[model samples]
Target chain A: MALNFLIQLLVNGLIIGLLYGVVAMSFVLIYKSSQVVNFAQGEFLLVGAWACWWLLAKFAIPFYLAFLLTLIFMIIFGILVQIIILKPLIGEPIISIIMVTIGLSIFFQAIMNWMFGVFTEPFPTIFNTESIKIFGLNVQTAYLMSGLISIFIMISFALFFKKSRLGLAMRATAFDQQAAQSLGVSIKQVFAAAWAISAMVSAVAGVVFGIVNGISSGIAFMGIKVFPAVILGGLDSVLGAILGGLAIGLLEHIAHYVDVQFLNVGNLIRIAPFYALIIILMIKPYGFFGTKDIERV
Target chain B: MNLKNSRPCGDFRTSYFKDMSMFEDKKGFFLTCFGVFILSCSPLFLDSYLISLLIYIGFYAIAALGLNILVGFTGQISVGHAVFFGFGAFASAWLNNSFLIPVFFCIPLAAILTAFIGLLFGIPAARVKGLYLAIATLAAQFIMEDFFSRASWFTGGVDGASAEPLKIFGIFFDSDTKYFFIVLFWMVVSFIIATNILRTRDGRAFLAVRDHYLSAEMMGINLMKYRILSFGISSFFAGLGGALYGHYLNFVSIEEFNIQLSITFLAMIIIGGLGSIRGSMMGAAFMVLLPEIMDWLTRSLSGTSIDSALSLSEAIPFIKEASIGLVIILFLIFEPNGLAYRWGQIRAWFKLYPFSY
Candidate 1:
């Protein structure tokens, strides 16, 4: 019975981990190109989820159509945000850039609260099956769908970066901007593409999370929760993001299980990721997949 | 030493002592003194509401001053400063409630305890820098918040802990006017301490690390010590400010110390000026006043030139948030050094009025 429960927890954790990885990908995408740590990444998820939900619930659009529209809208929104707010801040200090993103996050949160009202709403069950017994364990259909979609996106992302022309340009820009610019890569275009792609990814994560859990302002905290995953994977590594997300998700579930079954400690699951993060940072600051930045006098 | 062209032409110093003086001329010194006099006495004529606002501004200034030491002076960014502030609140509340500690004793005791906690958090800084340090501090924030929520006996859990009224000697500081003096006193003390620290060797080490860490280490500076010291100093003020805030509100809750509050503290330091002590104060005042000013402006302009469909009351919070964000973005893009830099420019412009260049 205990072994079965552990297996169930593993399945649950992997699903949540994939969701976190999706958001972490959004974070890493922007960070890779612009060197700007976009604190507003979570707000992208909030906005996308709200847009998708609004279209589906308010306008009575079908789930796929609403989802597609939300993705497209988020892509445009991301590009516009980059062009307007981020472009002008290209050469500023890291702190200033960071503060701007922080400001944008607050702005987005307040705007969302105003638009959506301060309450949680259960997402429409677009999936036909609410739950399915997989190997004698109950699994949420939304979670399974989200996991599969995330895997598909991840695979496509790996391929896109490996094969596409734009992907090559983005990689060059991330590796070294001056060299990339010298090679005729438009830094502006790369930045815009990065933002657009990341926004779309975050939108997918948001919609999936909203469907699996519920849509609310509380969803914005996912960015903070996902930060540990991002750090654990290595800040600049896309592959690291997925692994870190899975690890954190597993850790959280295990912590929860331990707390309930043995220690009876309250809120250990919430603190577990940070505990892992600090220890990991102490042991290897660059993380598993992050490149070490050598400093010299 | 005169690095910028905007510096006033007459500002020439003959000796090291003269160069190191806080004010270049007697005019600046007397002006500051006169300003302080007016500020100290203003509560007499002002309404209680304005006095309360002043108290909040004072505490924010204290917090921002501390933040400036770490971010501006030390070049380390922390997005989770609210955790330290919240820690101080709970610490003071516990000391006051359980131990029957005096108001004066609890404030510093809480600050020291908070600083120690900050130092513990700062351990991650030894291995990380820049954005990495930020994420680590964010971890600190989440961990601290979790502790607050789970430690129900000490922190009162999600329900929150009530702080006893602050009493000094036989006088109870319950009224806004009475509390205004307490906040003002601490704010001034914090400013003086920060000023003194900035003028000392450790302060120069912070500046060196900020300017270039590689060169700072080459100069034989202990990076870990200064980094942890900066965190300690910053959290000390955060805790003191948080404690004062609790007493002012008469209640402390975990909800009050969320990431948004931390961001606001960051916003205060950025909008005011990053490295300047005066900038921290100005930023604090600006942050506290901006919302009130926006509310008033919206009330007057509502349904006139603005949208008729959306109610002004409903839109006020969004407007407040967007404006703050916009202000930070605009300041970062146009004037990265913030309001203090602008103030210096205006002074220089006035000084060289005929030439104007």
Candidate 2:
């Protein structure tokens, strides 16, 4: 029984970690390229989940189709947000751009509240299957499928960055905007593309999160949680984001299981990632896999 | 430098008085004093609701002034300022409820504790700058809020803690009119202190570091000392604002001091003009007053029942939040220098009227 509980906890933690990894990737992509930590990345997740639900419920679309449609919508939304709001303010100060994004996040939340009303909605599972027993441990099929899908996405992204033309362009832009622009790389287009890809990634992650925990305004707040992940992994490292997410997930779960007498381990579970974040910041500042040169002083 | 062009007037006494005067000229000084007198007595003629709204404006202005010190003058980005404000409110609330301390004492105590916390956090700030520092501060905000919500002893958990009405000299300040005077008095004191601080050497150091840290450091200024001092002073005033907010509401909650408040404070600084005292007050007043005015207008319109689809309250909240977002965006794109800069230009134009340049 103890072994079974342990397996169950491991499975749950990995699944949660995978979802965080996907969301953290969105943040990592934007931060890696633009050197701007997009605080509204979580809102993209929220919007994606809502869009997926609307597609399924209001339009009676199939699960897979709805997911694809939602991804496309998010990509377009991301690109437009960049072009309309972020692009013109490129030469301006960092605070202006940061505040603009903050404003955009608030605006998006207000719009979402207006459109969806402040009600939590349960997303329909893609595969209507029960928990699968593996070595006397019950694991939900949804968790397994979503976790695998997240891994698949991460692998594909890694491969794309390594080999693809657009990916190289993005890399070039991230390295030096002036050089990229001089080489006729269209820095604006790269930014737009980065935002689009990040938003789509955020959508998928949001759907996974919604499927597991249900959806509400709280889903959008996950963006803030992604901060600890991004910081831990190194703000500019994709693989680091994934590793950081999993580490946070595992740590929080283990902490919860330990159960200290004076403290409510369960309550601390929610803020565990942030606590880890504080410690990491105090020690490393730049994060585990991040470049030391990226450290600002 | 040429003395004639550098000096505003030929007479040494005239130039000295001009620089020494709060408004720089006879006309400007009187206009400002008149504006203050009108603002102070506004609560007498206004309704209770309006007076209460103005009191909130005063509170935000004070908080914004603190933020201006950090972001505007010190050239640091702080997304965690709400945490300091929250700390102040929580500390004061706990003290007021447990020991039954007067609001006056609680306010300063809260400010001092918050300044201490700010100084602690500012240590990391000595090694980091800009966005990295912002992230660290942002982490502090999350940690503080988590502690407030989870640790029930400090913040009374999610349900929030309530406090007794503010009392001065054993007299209860239950009425909005009474609270208005209390807030207004503090606001005036803060303005006076903030203005005077800017004229001092420490204030010049803040501006020096903000404009060019390396140059300031080269000139023998201690970066760590000045940076931390700015943070400490900024947090002190933020605590004052939070304490005042607690007194006004007679209640405090973890939800009240969130990232949203930080964003609103940032928006005020952005809109008001970062380094100027007048800019902070104007930014605070606009942010607080705009929403209240919008809500009032919504109520009046809804009373006539033009839109049957949505309730006024629901619509108002959405509009208020959206407008804040919109205002920040619009201001960033068009008026990044903020309202105070524009006000300065207008005043300059009038002062140099016949010359036109």
Candidate 3:
């Protein structure tokens, strides 16, 4: 019985981990291109999910069409945020940028709460037949779809960075800003694009998460959750972020199992990642794939 | 019309004593004295609500001063300061209630205890700096929060902890009016210590480390020692304020200390003016009053069409939280130097009159 329950958790962990990977990927995209650690990344999820839900519920539109509209809205929304909020802070210190993002997070969170009451609102039932048999476990159709989407998104990202024009420009900008500028890559365009793509991707993750477990202000915790993942994987590595997200997801579930069986110390699932975070920071400030940042002057 | 008192520009120092004086002139000393005198007498005339606001500003400003000493002076960014403040509240309450110590003695004792705990967390700070250090502190915040919830014995568990009011020589300061004096005394002491610390050699070392750690090391300054020392001193101030706060309320709760409170402290230091002690106080005062102003605005607007349409009362908490973010962004964009620099500019405007641009 215990083994079966553990297996079930492992399966569930993989699904949530994939969603975490998608969110962390978007997070790394912003950090690599702009060097701004976005504290409001979860707010991106909150906004996107809320926007999609509003469209579906208010307009009574079909789910696919509403999802498409939400993506479009997120793209424009991300661009405006970059231009208006982050552009003027281009040359500012790291702390200022961090504070601005933190401010943005708080501001947007409160605004979202105000506009949409703090209740958990479910996505208008998208899947007619809910449970699908994956191996032996009964998997929700939304989880399976989300898992596939996350994998598809990862493959596209790999190919885009390798071949696409804008992707190469973004990679160039991330590598060396001055070098990229001299080579004709526009930093401004790259920054706006990074934010737009990030916001759009985060929105998709938000919708997936909402479908799995209804949408509320609580979804914003994913932003904070992203920190342990990103730090574990290394701040700048895209692949590292995905792997780190998976590790944290698995760790949380395992911790939960241990809590139920032995210690019975509640909330270990949430606290374990942070404990892992501190250990990671202490031993390896730079994660598995990240470049060493300490410059000896 | 006296240039000695309101000197807008130029160097007038003739000796080391003149250069290192606390106040610029007799006028500054007298003005400060007069202000404190007025505030000390406020309990007689002001209502309980206004008095409570001043007391709130008192503890917050003390805590902000501690934050500024570490962040503004030493350039160590900490996201886990509220935990230290919470620790102090717990420590002081524990000392008073558990061990049966006097509140007056427990306040300083608690602060000293918090400083030591701060050094333990400051270990990561010794190896890392900037963004990495920020993340490390972020992790510390979560871990400590978990500890607070778990350590029911020390923090009074779910029921929460209660503290004794300040007592000295059989006199109990059990009311807001009496507690006002205790807060005022500590506020003055904290500001003066902060001012004096900046003029000392150790303080200069902190500045040196902040400007260039490499050069500071070359100049025989111990980078790790100063980094850790700044954290200790900062925590000391946080503990002092927390102890006062616990006694004032006569209770300490677990849920009150969180990331939002930490962010609010950051907002206080940023809005007041980074690296300026006076700015910390201004920022704290502004922060304390910001919610009240929002409440007033929302209450007044409730009868208008906007209120009827949106239901203003229900959204008050949201509005207040949003305003803190809005204020931080506005301050960072327009007044990055904070209110201290703005105050200077305003004084210069009047002094220079038509010549001012």
Candidate 4:
């Protein structure tokens, strides 16, 4: 029974980890292109989820269609955010840019709260069954679907970055902005594309998360919760993000399990990622996949 | 204006003491004294609500001063300052309640304790730089908030701890009017210390490290020591502010020191002007008053024809938040140096009013 429960927790962790991976990918995409750690990444997810849910529920649109429309809207929204808000802060201090994003996050949260009335809402039911037994263990159907969808998204993203021309340009730019600019990679367009892609990825994460857990302002916290994941995998690496997300996801579940079984404590599961972060930072400052920046100072 | 008191354009100082003095001249001295005179007396004339606002502003100014030291002066960005603030609140609350310590002694004791705790978290400053350090501080925020909220013995769990009314030497500061003066005294002291620190050797070293860590290191400035020292000092101020906040409110809760509060402090420092003592104070005052301004705006608009379409109450929080966000963005883009720079520009313009170029 204990073994089965452990397996179930492992499965649960993988599903949530995948969602975290998508959000972390969005973070890496923006951070890779522009050095700005967009604090609004979670807000992007929240906005996308809300948009999709609003379209589906309010307009009576189909799930897939609403999802696609939300993705497109998110892309435009992301591009506009970059062009309008971030573009002006091109040469500003990193702290200043970070503050802009922090401000943006607060603004986005308030907007969501104002529009959504500070209440959690269930997404229009897409999955037929509530729960499914997989190998004699009960699994949430929505979570399973979300897990599969996230995997599919991750695979496609992996291919897009590996083979696509725009992906190569983004990669080049991330590698060396000035060199890429000299090589005729329009740094401006690359930044726009990066932001667009990042938003789209976060939207997918948001939609899946909303579908599984319901839509709320709490969803935005995932953007922050995923930081440990990005740090674990290496801030700039795509694969690192995925692995880090999975690790954090698994760690959370395991932490909860341990808390329940051994410590009999409640909140330990919630803070597991932060604990993991401090430990990882102490042990490996650059993380598993992050570049070790050698400062002259 | 007296010739000795006024700093006329093109005037040269005859002595080093004249150049290095805190006030530019007697005019500055008189103006500051006038400002303090007004502030001290305002509580008597003002209503309780306005007095309370002043108290909160004073608390924020102290915290913002500390933040300015770490962020603006030392170039160490910390988003988890509210943790220290919260810690201080709980410390003072617990100390006053359990140990029967005087509120006067408890305040500085809480600050010192918070500074030591802050130094522990500042350990990562030696390893992490820039974004990493920010994230590290963020981890500190989440971890500490989690700990404080959960540690029922220390924090009283979610319900939190009640602060004893501040009583120093048989004097009861139970009312906002009384609390206002207490907070004002602390704010003034914090301001004096911040200014004096800037003029001191360690403070200059902080500036040097912030400007160019590599050069400062080459010049034998210990990065680790100063970085940690900066965190300690900043957290000390946060604690002092937090203690004042608790005593004035007569309660301490974990919720009061969440991420939003942290952002608000950052907003105070950023909008007021980074690295400037006066600017941080201005930022604190601006932020403390912002919610009231928003409420006033919302109240005036509530009865408008558009209220039916969009409830004003539902949108007020968003409007306030969005406006603050917009303010930070606008300030960053248009006036990154913040209100302090603008103040200096206006002063310069006035100094050369007729032929201002």
- Residues B292-324, candidate 4: write the lDDT tens digits: 898898888887877767887668778887778
* lDDT of model 3, residue B26: 81
C-alpha lDDT of all candidate models, in order: 0.88, 0.83, 0.90, 0.89
| Cα TM-score of candidate 1 | 0.95
lDDT of 3 by residue, A103-222 (tens): 999999999999998999988899898989877888899989989989988999999999999999999999999999999998999999999999999999998899989999988999
1 or 3, greater by DockQ: 3
- Model 2 regions lying over 4 Å from their true place: A1-3, A259-262, A294-297, B1-22, B97-100, B150-154, B157-159, B300-306, B309-313, B349-355
lDDT of 2 by residue, A209-239 (tens): 8887778888987788787887899888888
Cand 4, B chain, TM? 0.95
Q: Which runs of model 3 end up more than 4 angstroms from their true locations?
A: B1-8, B354-357
Q: Clashing residue pairs in candidate 1, if any?
A: none
lDDT by residue for model 1 (A82-119), tens: 99999998787788888888888888888888788879
lDDT of 3: 0.90
lDDT of 2 by residue, B1-357 (tens): 677544352224546545655555566578878987997889768999888878888888888999999999999899988988888888888888888777678888988888998898888776777767777778778778878887688789988887667787788988899888888888888888887887778988999999999889889888999999999989988988888888778888889888889999999999999888889988988898878778778877875656455665667788899889989988988898999999988866765665764
User: Which of the predicted structures, 1 or 2, would earn the higher lDDT when compared with the native?
Assistant: 1
lDDT of 3 by residue, B1-357 (tens): 676565555447889998888898787799999999999999999998999999999999988999998888888888888889889999999998888888899998999999999887777677788887777888888888889898999998777789889998999998899999999999998889889988899999999988888999999999999999999899999999889999999999989889998999999999999899889999999999999999999999988999989899999999999999999888888888899989878866776776664
Error of 3 at B190 (Å): 1.2
Candidate 4 ranges beyond 4 A from true positions: B1-6, B10-15
Ranking by TM-score: 3, 4, 1, 2
DockQ each candidate and list the results: 0.64, 0.67, 0.72, 0.73
Candidate 1 steric clashes: 0
lDDT of 1 by residue, B171-272 (tens): 999999999888888987898899889888999999999999988998999898898899999999999999899889989988989877888889888888
